[model samples]
Target: MKRRALAVTLPLLLMALALLGANALITPARADEADAPALAAVAQAGANTAEWTVEQMDFTSRYPQGFVFTLRATSSGGEIVSARVEWMHRPHTRAKEPISVRRATGEIDPNTGLITATWEPTQSTAVPPWVGVYYRWRLRDAAGNEFVTDEGYAEYADTSRPWQRTETDEVIVFANGLSDEMGDLVAAAMDAQRQKYLDGWGQALPYRPRVILFGDMETWLEWQIGHQDTTGLGIVRVGVTSDEWGGTVQVIYGTEEELAYGTVLHEIEHLYQREFLAGRTVFTPGWFIEGDASFYQLDDVHRVATDYVADLVRRGDLPVLLQGEGPVTFGRNALHGYYLGYKFFEYLDRQWGIAIHRQIMDLLVQNMPFTEAIETATGQSVLELERAWREWLGAPGVVPTLIPTWTPLPFLASPTPMQFGSGK
Candidate 1:
């Protein structure tokens, strides 16, 4: 079904709308998967598929409590046996390589596929989470035959054990590599991010997010895919309550080597936007969210937009800046959102000063319509803001080529003239 961005436009509309219609049938974020029981216990799957009782599962490292498990599958005819195990948490890498399959106990009946060998950890062996290993019971009945268990997702050793008080908010490195201070540093970064999330969005969303940061893309993608399977919800990189598993913010600042602190500040501003300023379902304009965040982080308004809008103006395409319509995605599509958002936000900050943005946010929370809120807060309607945005793009004042990497000058009372000014 189609969704709308904002209410009807006025006759003096300068900027074109940015947000497009989207389906709003969002889903819950938590995933709860069922376990398999077709291991050691008698189970059947269609014809020729025999049952094998799963015996044991062991984890090499830490996972979420009560969730990670392993199992041993044994054929009823004394044919085959094996273990399905889970990997401990690690960086979310998407690399694919042959797993070095080994065990100290090589107790496997080759004819029957039975093994009871326990794993021995060496100096350099890292296993990913939920790495289920299976042994097929290849046998010869009256007629030569082949068979494998259909017990999907065999259990692993329950590494998700009861938590200790000290373990709360602490690191659980499987191979034991982290120093106390390093672990604390990681904890502090996470805790600070968490607090930022809470502070920005506490009133509307009132639960702690179960945050997962992986070392590589594969692990992260796997968890997200599994989450989609379990919850029937494709994550949209938006904020969530406790149930939502994958919360994300891009670390890059559009360039190869911008300071990471700005990225953090930018994302945190989004948290505040989601919680306090915009609609729960109806997304705020991307321009506003990222722009505000960038504005807050850098504390600049004119030049940032000028750096961008000036380019467009020099190219005779200044109309893009005048389009103050809502940002299509809420906290996402950031370049389309943040870069431009930052610039636009900069212009508005210069236009109305910082206080007006705050006033606009308050008006939004009070359920004021976006256009009406702009008018009420700044005493200038959204259209006026657009005209102000357009004029700021190519004002005759000699804007220097070396726009400040620092701060922007405050906006003066320059309303749109009866006729639009031409030429830069």
Candidate 2:
């Protein structure tokens, strides 16, 4: 659930992870779901004194693909018209589309006063392991009486992978065929700094985010959303996070220190954005999203972003801030927006204190315009804020005239510490 920051090093590896173009894209729902009948209207409660109820619900591993979903229910009405299971990987958020499936045909027992249904979980690669699936049951009876159950969780664990799992009060890290150090690093980072995140955001997340580190390149590539030819780039798929699978961070293995100080925290910041900041506004500018993530990272975001942009400015190559796509670009070392946005945050932090981060997020969640959100959060208009930031940066007070002639510098030889899609 973290946004990709362009401020990272090792452009190739960072690019691979940032784009997520290498992971296999599997549909989230079962194939049959596409053709499943639409849900009927909710059946109103009727004369039956005893309402329908779900007696038991559980999940068991169906390795290599999905899980076994089982449940038992009873209805006083006796004749059940329909039973369904609904689930999502993230918490406190609705699926963009229906993720409910009708129970396979079954019979209700009169003497036992119960009915049972079992089915396989959706095997879509999108439903990777370590994600806590929030699920519930819905049932309707012959008399149109309806029943619904409280939500429960099922972890679609990848039993096939040799994952070393670690848990803390704040996070869960899963490392496959990698050193325990990596898992420990991620866990410790969250354990130590979760309170800092809580303080900055002014609230806690609805659910803990999962950090998944893949040790092998092939497995990493195999799990990506699309086929990528990394032949010439020397870009080993490094890291990723997704809002789709419950704010999970998926990355190639890194040392405990690397994860503790690197993209791990950056991506976790994204989870905070979703749970606390960007409410209901599904699409915001990349500048705000990635810049906010970079600001929260363990490293010195101000210095890094400032230096990157300053260098561009010295060369007369600084692009307009709010320009096309807001700083995320495809070529080498091109995510100026990350730093530009970070500078914006830095200016806000200096003038308004860290609470401004929460304030801005609050305004954004209300679907306010970006300029208005900044003005309201900081008590200054957008132009005023921009002028102040440029003054601090020792650059011109206004956006520099954009130079159309620009090319990326050569790829860096070393990797930098740095850090999607709907379910099918």
Candidate 3:
């Protein structure tokens, strides 16, 4: 089956610092603009005990290449000795530290008190266009006095295209080669499912997520820096989410309506999973992860998946639940796991409600085993739960007895890719 998968990776923790408040001013700059400056704050004469002043602060977006930060300051106490720029893609979360705080030492000219830092793209560090970058500067003078500026924010925008943006409290939608109506449709979908997300996950994401839609494959591949093959390893990467970017980056594959309503929401659920369950020592099966994400898709997509899985149940070909390599995650019929997994969640929602869904997720967050968490939340063993779920799907309440041998694959850094939407 040709499928779109979100290849989850353990995000790198590059740097760490004391948490800062969210009240910092955001200054956006486009790369096409000539000499775009962001977050300029002139220091008053008496603002510092060391008589140091910030003359200017600026940021320049270089698009797919990289970005640059420039600082000019004067300190009467002593000549400026060192300067550093620190940035994170998203704000810090109470659940954990910020996804990543990248720090780069700036080249300083002591005579001019000028500092410059440039972040270039590497295979591991490349972020898609329009990802929010929150940053600040730290400076020290020869007198051993240090100063840290208030946080500033900017978008890593691809200014080559005519991009339309729409913002709501829940999400920010950016679309290129598409109408503003496309952005509005995505925003509407997020708004429609806001309450459902809260009910299922118990809270909103720590940061406002982004949905970047590209109208063509070339533009989409431009920012995919290191990975040039869109169809490598026999998987079609229609959409992607990164913990580092804190949003979904997608190329328009199917109809705009389906992309907005189904694929967008499905990718956002993956972000929720990363935020809530990342770094915890918990056993999250591939089926549950992808299935729960699939559950959030709109009814049209849901019905199609439901019909596919229900046919399997009725034919008594249902795969065993929670077993070794429980569901195939790659190659032909990989979507079988996703479709069947959605049914398990559908059973929960129908049998109990979204409250049970939240309860089970809460248990998993506490590092409880998946089986134990589900049993605790629904008061049913794994086998019993499977039987009930099959019955709900118009099948006899008989759990499949086939148990595939579990041959362990080589340990990978990230979990197996959790796939969505089949190309059939």
Q: Which candidate number has the best lDDT?
A: 3
Better of 1 and 3 by lDDT: 3
Candidate 2 or 1, higher TM-score: 2
Model 1: lDDT equals: 0.35
Model 3 residue 369 CA deviation in Å: 1.1
Query: Once model 3 is optimally superposed onto the true structure by TM-score, how far is the C-alpha of residue 64 displaced, in angstroms?
Result: 1.8
Clashing pairs in model 3, backbone N/Cα/C closer than 3 A? 1-332
**Cα lDDT of model 2 by residue, 287-381, tens digit:** 66767777766655556777888887688665556422355523464466567767767777888788888787777767665667777877876
Instruction: Summarize candidate 3's per-residue lDDT along 293-396 as a digit string, tens digits.
Output: 88998848678887898788678787877654467655687788678778878879998999998999898778676678988999988888887777778888
Clashes found in each candidate (C-alpha, N, C closer than 3 A): 45, 3, 1
lDDT of 2 at 341: 69
Q: Candidate 3: worst 10 consecutive residues by lDDT? A: 1-10
Question: Candidate 3 overall Cα lDDT vs. reference?
Answer: 0.73
In candidate 1, which residue ranges exceed 4 Å CA deviation? 1-213, 226-259, 277-283, 296-306, 320-337, 395-424
